[model samples]
Target: MVAPTTPGTTPTPTNDAPVADAAARLNRLADGYLVTAALHVAAELGVADVLDRGACDAERLAAEVGARPGPLSRVLRLLVAEGVLVEFPDGTFSLTPSGRLLRSDVPGSLRGVVRARGGVYATAAPALAEAVREGGVAFERARGEPFFEHLAQHPAELAAFQASMVDRSARAAADVLAVYDFGRFRRLVDVGGGFGVLLSAILTATSGVSGVLFDRAEVVASARVPEGTEVVAGDFFAGVPAGGDAYLLSWILHDWDDADARRILTRCREAMGPDGTLLVVDAMLPERAADGPAVIRLDVTMLLLATGCERTGREFGELFASAGFTLRRIVPTASPLGLVVLEAVPA
Candidate 1:
């Protein structure tokens, strides 16, 4: 038996133990889909919600979740192995801290995200290799249509997608507010602001700032804008409404490829005045993938679902320059989503 590392060396020595550990990691990576499926099942069945009250026997949990006793017990046991659930000798299970995120009502609950993954992302997973090879969207490859077009036809999936965005936005909204000061701007326009979640939060936090929530007619119709805030429905590709001291494209640009993203920014630039600011709040990919795995994973998600690609700082600067704006600075935020505020000004 040899030690995996040499004393005071930078890199670990390639001993048998290190090789075995690496092999185990590869094995876990290969079987990652099993964990995803188990998590999706728990979320869909409301396992955490049921266990939120207290621990219960597998039989009781199975009955409550409308699953067969044996199968449900197996799922619970798997969850226990995954550290999402704790099983006692009495054959009962309870939610772990990680499992509580599956509860729909919690502050930062990921129930909607889990549901979305299970519903659409899982379907698109098989097309990833094809997407890499053919240079087309994976969701379209799997479903025979674009992701948004498919969502339009499926109301349930649309609802789940919207809910998932809301859940993600809840944290991002707070992060945007914490990092940026909106008080300097009299008028703030949120371009492609879905449901006005971040806009509302901004207006509430910074008094005396009016906002305009702009999106499609169907999306804006259901949005609840704060009092004194204006809601205008329109597409950013065609044109964005004019005359705002600050324009926000929160989590929007990352949904398109370079050409389409440039089109969107160009429209915003046309609407922006000489002194106006363009703030794009989204994940800015780090130089090293290991530095920010979540953001890199999000880029993969973009590849699967949309034409988007998460840009590095240099990439974003180029995008801004092409759209007739100068990239000013990248502001970091406290959100776990690894959000960054890209502040740009008219060139």
Candidate 2:
């Protein structure tokens, strides 16, 4: 009902629609954890893989995946609502296009990421409030151990983490190679390169570029590097391999704070010649929060999990200057991860 206004007086208009819409948005946001949990359950049960073979009823799916029929059906319905799955008229379930990403054998499989987020990352969620109140890592407070140490102790979680990294790096590599010219360098060293995914891609794409894959001793032990790649097992904090015209630190710096990142950059500086080039592939945080919501979310994840943080272009420049390097140029990539190649040269 609208109240009548006197002459020459403005009447107040009433519209509850915007308020209702805002409330609905907030409600959806608040319930996001439920979707995450459901996705985790489905991923762990290999529901998408099973459905890829063919659609099946909840009871059959439950029998195959060792889940209770009722709960599985509820989860399937939730996924259908979320557009990750589709429900047939015959009460069977099938994977939607988005749901196919959960399959373990797929090109961009997110099963590992799902396992990690739903398992270890979820474990640290409760400590986020405490971490905000007290300046410390949420994972360390929640699990009573550092992030990497926890991964070391838990092999399955470690494998999942590695798999996620591989999936992410594999996708980013194509985008990087498409934009950057690694063929200019004679020798390329990939420091802290896990499993040599990026190195493999570079070697495959560029001719006359010999690669050196360097990482921890344990990491390089099982590394499946390309043929002719020189595998070196050592700690980057102590030192990195020398003699390469270009050194690549792909998706590495974001796992450390400024001081630690500087230490790493210093090591690379020490190992490389004055003419050597350093290429750091990482997510460049946008200056404005609204412009880079995904990166901001990753920064929050870093706060929850480790001492690392995503950095802006200016921050990377400062870090480079502090480590005796001059910021050469930033090459933009078409990666969905918002990755950029920050090219630097020794001061």
Candidate 3:
């Protein structure tokens, strides 16, 4: 039955339950920051690592991690609700399979990522609206310094950031090896290859292929590369290491906008021989939003953090053309990070 209304008045809805339900869902979506904060707290406290030994009540866990019992218990309950942990009948909580990834000592660990998200990235999130209204990088605007510059000043945060990259590259390296033939190249130069995770993996997989790991002096100072692999430190904008049949730009170009990306490509073009292959490992933004939700989300992160963007295949092609290279092929990788190897050759 419909409600009656005056001639000039709007009628009331017969059912408000669906509207209320939709509002509830929207509210949950808006509260996502709370989840991120909770995860960050857990990561900082090393909850997953402590629980790896055995399930324990929050009070004891709090004692181990130097947190308040009641508050930590509430946070643990929230994690259990979020499926990162499971509560036992006896009231102790245990890590779920997904929660195990938060352990700092484990392979594919995301503790560093959680810390980064909850720390440095979270600090920049509030400025997103301002950035949209006033054109500027959200992170720099919020922190009063560039992303890399800030990281350079904060060694602990830099380590967390680097660890996150290592985890991502470790996962992507296997997928890259599976899809691409690194054995074909005589010398492979990994430009801006932080920590040499991907470069070392390639050298191990491909025999007789010498490698050069290049990046900023500070970054390459602590890098661990395979035996006989040369490590050089320099600005990619100024120049890159030369004399390689293959120049690898793994996870680099997307950190800058088109103009800077083109400059990087130009440098790579100058550094390599006429027949050298340029392999760019990055996430290719899908034409449709629904097709690559993760990549789209990363694009937003890039907007918030740096003067960079994830681009579609057409954009990459255009950028390559501007830098005297032809887009040869984009080899898809099975990496969960949504990475693809964009192979190019000099024009």
Candidate 4:
């Protein structure tokens, strides 16, 4: 296979592998990225909404978006073949089931995700190798600044990132809740919970469960506090909200390394009542290190864009114990987001 020669590098067609394999990999990378860009543009143009009502040919759809049909047709054809759209014999196309994810109207949809990815995350993807060697996101190298700092400077991009996370939390939270039992806790705190979707889902599913959402000051400044939920502004690395019977960190730990994760966990441990529980909602890889590439690959993805890594259940057991939280149970969630509930007391 052709390897990227440098960070922020694209592997060009080369003589390393057999002609066909090299060509295929390079083509897949280049074409796939182009397709990613297409999805971004389609989501931005509200093409899914246009197609949601009915099918329209490229010319009409392009006209709706005030773009030329010739260029737009190429994108439509590529997406149709990719099952994002269904093409009719007459050349008009309609949205597919996957296309629903591109609509911003639906809860848990990927509209914001695709937009943010195509907008900002894509810029960081190519620099993945540098990030791997450097132990943090190559955002600085890629964009000349820290990720959150860049977000702070660009309000619109920050909004897009938060919206993307909020939408994505819905897509994964239901399956997550399905896999974990919320029967043990009365009140919970969501550290870095964007829009409190996961906490709301947990509370909505379990009776008499109230929750608190702690996030950045600006991020939570305008967040609507849903019924039975309180929203607060705080830093996770510094500390978190207090007085909850249980604490929850959903996909938050994966944004930081072991040290930062330990600090955050220590904060929660300090804040928890003697009987309080801590539920870490994350993707816990398998106990044995041999059977999976998905977990490790995603860890690599995190390394490329953030300073984090996915840990195995055994790793969690070790990490939890170190942070003064006991590993009580590792519950498997329905989706990739696994649930590992730890407690303040020893197991």
TM-score to native of every candidate shown: 0.91, 0.93, 0.94, 0.86
Per-residue alpha-carbon lDDT of candidate 4 for residues 1-347, written as tens digits (9 for 90 to 100): 56558878766755656677758988887788888888988987888888887899999999897788998889888898788998999999898899978877686588888888888777888777776686557766798787777887888888878878888678667777766777777778898887777777777888877889898877877576567578888788788888888888888888787888899998888888778788787777666556555566556657666777788777777888888877877666556444444333433
Q: What C-alpha lDDT do the candidate models reach, one value each?
A: 0.88, 0.90, 0.91, 0.78
Best by lDDT: 3
Per-residue alpha-carbon lDDT of model 2 for 117-232, expressed as tens digits? 88788889999999999899999999999988787788777777777777777788889999998989999999999889899999999999999999876667768888999999
Off by over 4 Å in 1: 1-19
Error of 4 at 301 (Å): 2.6
C-alpha RMSD by candidate, in order: 2.7, 3.4, 3.8, 6.1
Give model 4's TM-score versus the native structure: 0.86
Q: What is the total number of backbone clashes in candidate 3?
A: 0
**Model 1 C-alpha lDDT per residue in residues 77-107, reported as the tens digit of each score:** 8889999999988888998999999998688
> What's the C-alpha lDDT at position 38 in model 1?
85
TM-score: which candidate is best?
A: 3
lDDT for model 4 comes to 0.78
How far residue 26's Cα lies from its native spot in candidate 4, in Å, is 5.0
Whole-model lDDT for model 3 versus the true structure? 0.91
Off by over 4 Å in 3: 1-14
